[model samples]
Target: MWTLVLNCGSSSVKFALLDVQGGQVRLSGLAERLGSAGASARVEVDGARRVVDLAGGSYAEAFAVIAGALDELGVRAQVGAVGHRVVHGGERFSAPALITPEVLAEIRACVPLAPLHNPANIAGIEAAQAAFPDAAHVAVFDTAFHQSMPEVAFRYAVPGDWYRQHGVRRYGFHGTSHAFVAVRAADLLGRPLSELNLVTAHLGNGCSVCAVQGGRSVDTSMGLTPLEGLVMGTRSGDVDPGLHDYIARQAGLSLSEITAALNRESGLLGLSGLSNDMRELEEAAGRGHAGARLALDVFVHRLAKQMAGMAAAMGRVDGLVFTGGIGENSAWVRGAVLARLAVLGARVDEAANAAAVRGQSGVISAPGALAALVVNTNEELMIAQQTQTLLAEQKGVQA
Candidate 1:
């Protein structure tokens, strides 16, 4: 049976059709620029790529285009389940849920926690349900994996009422990627996930680190939202709470304006005063750009710092796993970050690090050093697997 996984953003939808038993991607594509003049859908199947115009379209139109493409490709009858990636489940959902009216209402209640993401996610879930009413629909939450965090790790040093009344605490994001990479790391090490302790770094446009012990998340970098962890492509990771008041008083900037700058104009872009892309920053630094060099330095330094903290959470680190764009492709970044972690016995083979790039997976640790690995993450595949499992459980219960 094939499971359809959908990741809906504010203006785009990424999808994959996976053979659940074999764990193979049968069809994958993206719909971009939805609800705009440039809207289009691109689908890849059977080693061929096709693009369909969806100009001035909505999610419904985008789904139609995908369905039409599947029909043309003769795989329309293969879909058995639909998986929707919901960004935040708040404190409620701890696992992938079969979508019912009650579950849908619970998801709707989480809109306030993820104002910019959950609404789009809900829309995608509703649209997919309509498009495949016969198929079982499951909601896979990004926050689900981190629900294993203990109270001490997730709580803030704030008034008890803030957490008790508002649900304000460290509800880590990137739980899917973190959980996927942790299991992949265990596989690469030829060990069971429940027997290993790992620190996972997911470095991309957005960055987060996770500490996993006995196959469960103990601590993660992101908190309450995606903007609270390691420095990212645009979002400032961690700033003193007082800085907001300072900026407001000294620069005459409104709270909203400051919030926008921190979310959009900060991070690598703000530090380098150039591009947010790590590739560009690295190139500029090589050419003697002071700001770029500083940005890279700060990024590496902060990442290493957070990684060490993750190790502390696990008490002992059996391995270190790197994923996402920067973590997988940038040999320099892997080396730089690991250089700081030598104190923890984390040392990478320079040659092996160079060889592990662009979706390549391997152990880059020097002989006898703590195992360090580069594992490519597949959040979509993970979601599909979870969806398939949930559907089977539902069927068994009914039977």
Candidate 2:
């Protein structure tokens, strides 16, 4: 069956059409700069790639362009279903679901918790349903995998009525990525997931750490929002609660201004005074760029400390899986984190770590090194699988 996976952001949409029969992606692309001038769609099919200037105005038009291209390519395979990567489930959805009008409205209502993501995700789902009325549309939430978190872990130490009424609790993000990587790591290690305890570090533009025990998420670093985790490309991860009030009083900055700064102008960009891209920062650091060096150091330090804490929480971290753009590609960052982790028996094989750059899954740990790995995460595939599973269940229910 053919499954099309859609991940929509504020102004961009990423799409992939996967052929589950052979477990291959038939086509993948990104519609960048949507709702802005000079929007374009970059797509690759069978190793052939092309970037086309989009005349479309909004996400709907952009998707229409993509569909037209797929038609041109003669990819006539019937799409069995479409899967969406939704950022928040808000305790309502515990697994992937068939999108109904009520389900779409619930996802829309979650826009407050994910102002920059949920609306776009909802838009994509609506567009797909409009474009392909026959194909079932599924939503696989990023917060779903962490739904296993117990009340003690997910609850905030606040007023009782607040959480009891307002849903004021932890809802970890990056669930799909963490879930995909941890399962793959277990498989690569040739072990049953139930027998493994894993700490998955998803480091990218947005980052988070997950404590996976018995193949289920026991804890995660990212709290209610993506803005709460490890230092990211632009977002400040963890911060002192008092700093907000102090900054407002001292700098005369409004709450919204500070929020914008923390969510958009901080992290690697703020620390490095250069760029948020790790590759650029790494190169600059190599040239004795003080700010860049400091940025890299801080990133690695916080990551190691977080992983160490996750290990403590899990009681025993039998596996460490690193995924995401930086985690899967940056050997220097991985080595630095692992080196600091020697305190927890997490040692790395420098050679294996370096060789892992080509996106191969392997143990980057020394022979005696306590379980460490570099696994490339395929969140789209996970979404597709969830979609297929849910669609099958729907069919069974109807049958």
Candidate 3:
């Protein structure tokens, strides 16, 4: 059976078609800069990439174009299911779910928590469902796996009524990626997941640290929204609540305005006054750019600090797994982050660390290093697995 996975953002959609029999990606692509004149699509198949120019259009149009392309290429193989990466499933969805009308409605209602994300997520899922109506639809939430967190970890120290009535809590983001890497780490180590403890750091444009104890998420960074985690490419993580009011009064900015700045205009780009891409910042820092140097230092500082705390949360780390773009390819970033964890025996073999760059996955630590690993995150594959599981479960019920 094949599964098509979709992760939709505010202005872009990423897709992958996987042949789940062997867990391989048969095709993948992105429709980026959508809803704008500069919109375009890039598809990769058979290890070759082709870019298609797509003018300003809706996600439904993009979906149609993709489906039409697949048909034209005579690659319209029947799919067993479609999995969507919904950003917020609230407290209701604790696992990947086959989408019913009621499930779709619940996703739609959670838009208030993910104002910029859930709408696009729903659009992508609906479009894919329409495009492949015969296929089962599954909602694999980015928030679902982290729902296992304890109340003490997930709760905010706010009024109980606010949490009870407003759904206020720490619903960590990057849960899908963290869950993917943690399981992979356990697999690579040849240990049953329930016997392992892990600190998985997902460092991308957005970052988060997840403490996976016994294969379940015990705690995680990011709270209620993606903006509350570790320092991101442009998001300020863990800022004082009073700063919001203070900045609002001082700058005459509203709460939303402050949030926009933190989520969209801060992080490395804001700190370095250069770029959000870590590669760009690394290059700039190498050129003796003061802000860029400081930005990298600060980024690594916060990232490693959070990793240590997460390790502590798990009591001891069976493995420290790093994933996401920067974590996978940036040896310097990984080395710097690991350097700060020497106290925990997190020693990286420099040679192994360097070789792990460029998407290679392996042990980057010394022979006796207590905990360290580089695992390329495969959220699409994880979503595909979940889709297959749900489909198989449905089949069993019918049987």
Writing each residue's lDDT as its tens digit, candidate 3 over 1-399 gives 667888988889898888877877767899999999888888887577888878656787778777866675566667767889999999999998889999999999899999989999988888888888887889999999899999989999999998999999999878779988988898888899899999999988989999999989989989999999688899888888899999999999999999999999999888998889999999989999998998899999988888888888778888889999988999999999888999888888999999997779998999888768999998999888888988898899999
- Models ranked on lDDT: 1, 2, 3
Candidate lDDT values, in order: 0.92, 0.89, 0.88
Tell me the TM-score of each prediction against the true structure. 0.97, 0.98, 0.97
Top candidate when judged by lDDT against the true structure: 1
Between candidates 1 and 3, name the one with more favorable lDDT.
Answer: 1
lDDT by residue for model 2 over 273-370, one digit each (tens)?
99999999999999999999999999999999989888888789898889999999999999999999998888899889999986777899999878
Global Cα lDDT for candidate 2: 0.89
Shift of residue 95 alpha carbon in model 3, Å: 0.6
Q: Name the regions of candidate 1 deviating beyond 4 angstroms.
A: none
Model 3 misplaced stretches (Cα beyond 4 Å): none
- Which residue runs does candidate 2 get wrong by more than 4 Å? none
Q: Which 10 consecutive residues of model 2 have the lowest summed lDDT?
A: 68-77
The better-scoring model by lDDT among 1 and 2 is 1
Query: Local error of candidate 1 at 156, Å?
Result: 0.6
Residues 188-254, candidate 1: write the lDDT tens digits: 9999999999999999999999999988999999998888989999999999989999999999999
